[model samples]
Target: MSELLLTVKELKDIEKYSADGYVLGYEKYTFFGASRFSYDEIASISNKANVFVLLNALIHENNIEDFNSEINKLAKLDVNFIVQDTGALSLILKQISPKRVVFNPYTMICNKNDFSAYQNEGILGIGISSQLFIEETIELSKLDNALILLYGYEPIYQSNRKVLSLYQEAKKVRFPNGQLYLREDTRDVLYSIIENEYGSVIFNCKKVNLIRRIKDIKEAKYLLIDTFLSSEDEIDNVIKELNE
Candidate 1:
């Protein structure tokens, strides 16, 4: 059986959902996603519940040092670090001891070969893309320590530029992180968009719901649920519904 992991974006959420399942804190995001907690807050959480940290970011050499400093603090905690970029992975693999990390390159892993490649590189695990079909997911699950995205809105597009910043300037409006969204003008579809100092990311219009297929993907070691866009009540409901 696989374990349930909840991705928390707020401090209050940490308290709300930590009891039901393992909590994953988003430490940084250079493309999309919402808020990140302070090292102190993360340290506090680690003292209580089973926790992990997502250091998924598209980083460059210039900002890599700052990124390293932040991760170095989190690395001290007894938590897994899910790395996304090659540079970040290299930094963690080379600098961090014991190599407690998961390689999740968004939608890059298409087959078992990809998993083997990552494993060979000393990654502890890999995050399976939600875009894959259920059958494909089951096939990928055969690999040891496979991590799959079982819920949340899938990211469709991400860019290094401050897209929301430009949009806000032109529209004369303020669209803070986790508050703004993008949609097709022709129809009503909610593609959530978030902007930070790093860049902007626009998620898919429909959030991925795979609770019904849990049994099928149970072979996977971990299933991740990103709740950055979900309200407290919504997250509570999802946890109840899934646990029941």
Candidate 2:
């Protein structure tokens, strides 16, 4: 368990970031900001650092056949798989090592009871829900083999429907293809959202920026920093801070 940076070369100096490893989104299974690396690229990155692939997309029925095919190709690489969907987990288990497959269904796991149950089911590790407040999260970090997606806007909701597309069509307006945020009339907070062919995902308004507390939360095995929605300067600052 080391620091993980979720990114693509969209940010420079990833190798110089000094993270325990680098994380890339699986083109077919991971959501927004997916690096969409080719198989040769996957092999290349693994040689540089430990590679973690996020298969966090809620797999649609039609994509299963193709996604499963991608899993087979990925299994040959020395990379760890972090998955959200149960069906995707089952697919990885069929080909990847159990130790390398991590179950990370966001916001579903909160307390020790839920975590214990997943452990009982033979899941080696799981990402702790970011919904838990600071003190509560510190307590859960005491548990063995836990991981925290400490910094970044965690995706709170995902749907198979193209909500944004429907909105654009109905309104007859175009939104930028880059990240967009939705805000309620009275609320100051804005929720980040993006839509692709797989679906739309709404991210938490308040990012879980806990980089400053890294030393205090030593019991947790892994701490993750996501670079999505961040510029090279932003992520560069983060990496420098973490290593300091």
Candidate 3:
């Protein structure tokens, strides 16, 4: 059976609810961080919760050293890391080891070959792409170490450029939370945008609600729930639905 892995966006979630298996977004590139958390802050949260750190930031050559340093520090906590960048993976493999690594290149592992390559690399677990059809996911879940995204906004675009910041400045408005939205000119689709020190990432407007389909992926190792840009009550309701 797969475990429900909730995303800890706010300290209030930690205070109000007990997340035995949780993932924390500590830096700017992730879901929670309009305000970045220090390593000490991360440690404080991990001490109270069973935490897995999300280092899904898009790493470039310029930030490789800084990224490596962060990973090295996180290794001391003895928590697993969910990595996106290849450079970050190399650092983890060298400094940490594949045992503590969970590879999630946001919508990249779509087929069996991808799964095999990752498994051969000694990766302990891998995230299935959110963009894949349910049938593809069902086929891939048979792989023993698959991690499926059971609920969340699917990430569509990510870039190091501060697109949201520039747009906010041009519009003469500050989105304090550093979140905004863009709608298609032809279609009625809206995409959520989050910008910070690391860069900007745009996600699908509608949340992916697979609470009803959990049985389809029970053979997997983990089921991820990303609670970004949601209210406290809304999050609680989702959790309640999952439990039922």
Candidate 4:
């Protein structure tokens, strides 16, 4: 059976459509500067579905104090925590027992060496980047680790500068919804939008998709199918198609 990993928004929709029976996983949009959810919120959501929560280290530029508190609360709920950041990772290892933690893609774990380093740190899984060639994935599978990706948009560039400025100037207007978009050369914009538009680009790098590379992930210890705003329907459809 195929496994799926969804952003918080898609998971919300899935809960509505599946009547709280759909197995759930959560990803923190760290690049977006969104606030961490409270423990009560986490438990409420997790209780609604078989859920695992990813702790975003990129949130507010990786506030260690806040990150620690959030993970502590999640651990109290007995919810699975996927963390990014060396400081956060080290803190979790030292403060929280290893049983409730998972490693997140934000850790930038790219190879077997990276994987080996985390194994003893109680990391149960490692997310492989979509940019990796098939050979790299084959090598990754040889290591004992769970891996995840989805057949959707990959996050690409991240910046400290407000990206929405470019769009406002080009369009000669501001967004009514107050959403931000970075301006780039026309060609660069198109390529970036197509290749890395899902995860927040303001802070985290763009995520790469491997929809065409699903077969490679099958060899992984676990496969996490991801979905963000642009391809929610596509995610559900893929899951249905693959599972059917």
Candidate 5:
């Protein structure tokens, strides 16, 4: 069976659901710096299963110099790093020599040419962006490179402007700790968040379910399922539905 990857925002989820006999991989949430959890707390989740640290370019863009150190710390715990920054990728390849790193598709890699560029940089895999269609996935699979098919919701809008605006507005409301409750309208939508970063973009596109599809994905050497804050049952359901 092909492996299932899940993105988590909490460490407790890892402890409770990932303790034993769970078919899931993990990617840390790195979009906002307000996770309130230290890297040590996040990396501890890796003990449950194969864990990958997702470092968003949005977060790393501000303090580019820290990328190497961040990667180094995570590497010490034997955690794989997944990145979106070209510069950071170069750094990891040069300094850390991480066991594996998947380039986040948020950078919008559309064709084989993009894959070729990263492949030259020694990147192990490329995440097919949410903007890509099935035809693009097939084309990407044809390329002589590793591929990560985005099997979950697509991260639609990422902007320092919008999130900042929301945070500012939340501060005004004094919303108990200035925590911005960013909500997306997903009503009547098979995919949610049509415009927000975590909004739904890909729909009815055959969620990487069939074993044949999984086999096609695994053929590329690495595979992952990208989902946000998914529960244990949800994770198990996706695996069962896909594997069946």
Candidate 6:
């Protein structure tokens, strides 16, 4: 059976819900995290909550020093890091045990060969890309040390450039909103978009519904529920289904 893990975008979620573990995001080191937590604020987190860091942003060359300093400090605390950049993964492994790190390159880690290559490095887990079709996911779930996305708006695109601000500058008026949506010419559904100082990320417009399918995915080591931009009502509904 897989362990149920949830993203803790707010402190309230920690008190209101239950799960095997929690993944928290801070504005400094994570992209697509709904909450803001400075380095000092989140470092003081209690060990009892089983909270960890979502350090999945692409670390740029200029910020490597700050990034390295942050991870090394975080390593001293009781936290596991879910990292995205391959460079970031190497740095994190040096500071903490490979068992405490999960390399989640989002769209990478699709096949068994790629999966095994990472596992051989002694990392705790690797994210099974949300872009993979259900059949592909079904096959990959049979493997060990897999972190599968069970629900929430999945991030399909990420960029280190300021997409929103650049567009706003071009338009001659401040867009005044970081949150926007995009739709293909032929598509009806909108893709959720959010931009921050670090970069911009585009997410699936709709939640990936797999709450009821947990039983079928018995081999996934961890099932993640990311609540990036979801509502409390939506979370409650999904929690109800998980309980059922």
Q: What TM-score would each prediction reach against the true structure?
A: 0.88, 0.90, 0.89, 0.72, 0.68, 0.94
Off by over 4 Å in 1: 12-15, 18-34, 170-178
- Write the residue-wise lDDT of candidate 1 on 1-244 in tens digits: 7777777767666666644345464546434443566677778778676666777778887889988887787788877677778888888888884257878887888799878888787677788777888898989987888888888888877678888788779999985544677778898877877766667778887778888888888888788787868776777777887878
Please provide, for model 2 over 1-244, each residue's C-alpha lDDT reduced to its tens digit, 9 standing for 90 to 100. Answer: 4545465653234555766767777657777653566677778777677787877887879889998888878878888888888888877666666677778888888999888777665655678898888887888788766788777778878888899999889999998777688998999998988888778988888777888887667778778777776666887788778767
Clashes of each: 0, 0, 0, 11, 3, 0
lDDT of 4 at 168: 63
Per-model C-alpha lDDT, please? 0.75, 0.76, 0.77, 0.54, 0.53, 0.83
CA lDDT, candidate 4, residue 17:
39
Superposition-based RMSD of candidate 6 using all C-alpha atoms, in angstroms = 1.5
- lDDT over C-alpha atoms for residue 27 of model 3: 62
Which stretch of 10 consecutive residues in model 4 shows the poorest summed lDDT? 191-200
Sort the predicted structures by TM-score, highest score first.
Answer: 6, 2, 3, 1, 4, 5
Best by TM-score: 6
The predicted structure with the larger TM-score, 2 or 5, is 2
Each candidate: RMSD to true structure? 2.6, 2.1, 2.4, 5.3, 5.8, 1.5
The predicted structure with the larger lDDT, 4 or 6, is 6
lDDT of 1 at 206: 78
lDDT sort, best first: 6, 3, 2, 1, 4, 5
TM-score of 4: 0.72
Kindly give the stretch of ten consecutive residues in candidate 6 with the minimal lDDT sum. Answer: 37-46
Error of 6 at 62 (Å): 1.4
Off by over 4 Å in 5: 1-3, 9-29, 32-37, 42-48, 59-62, 162-212, 229-233
TM-score pick, better of 5 and 6 = 6
Candidate 5: lDDT of 132?
Answer: 61
Better model by lDDT: candidate 1 vs candidate 5: 1
**Which residue runs does candidate 2 get wrong by more than 4 Å?**
1-5, 10-12
Candidate number of the best lDDT: 6
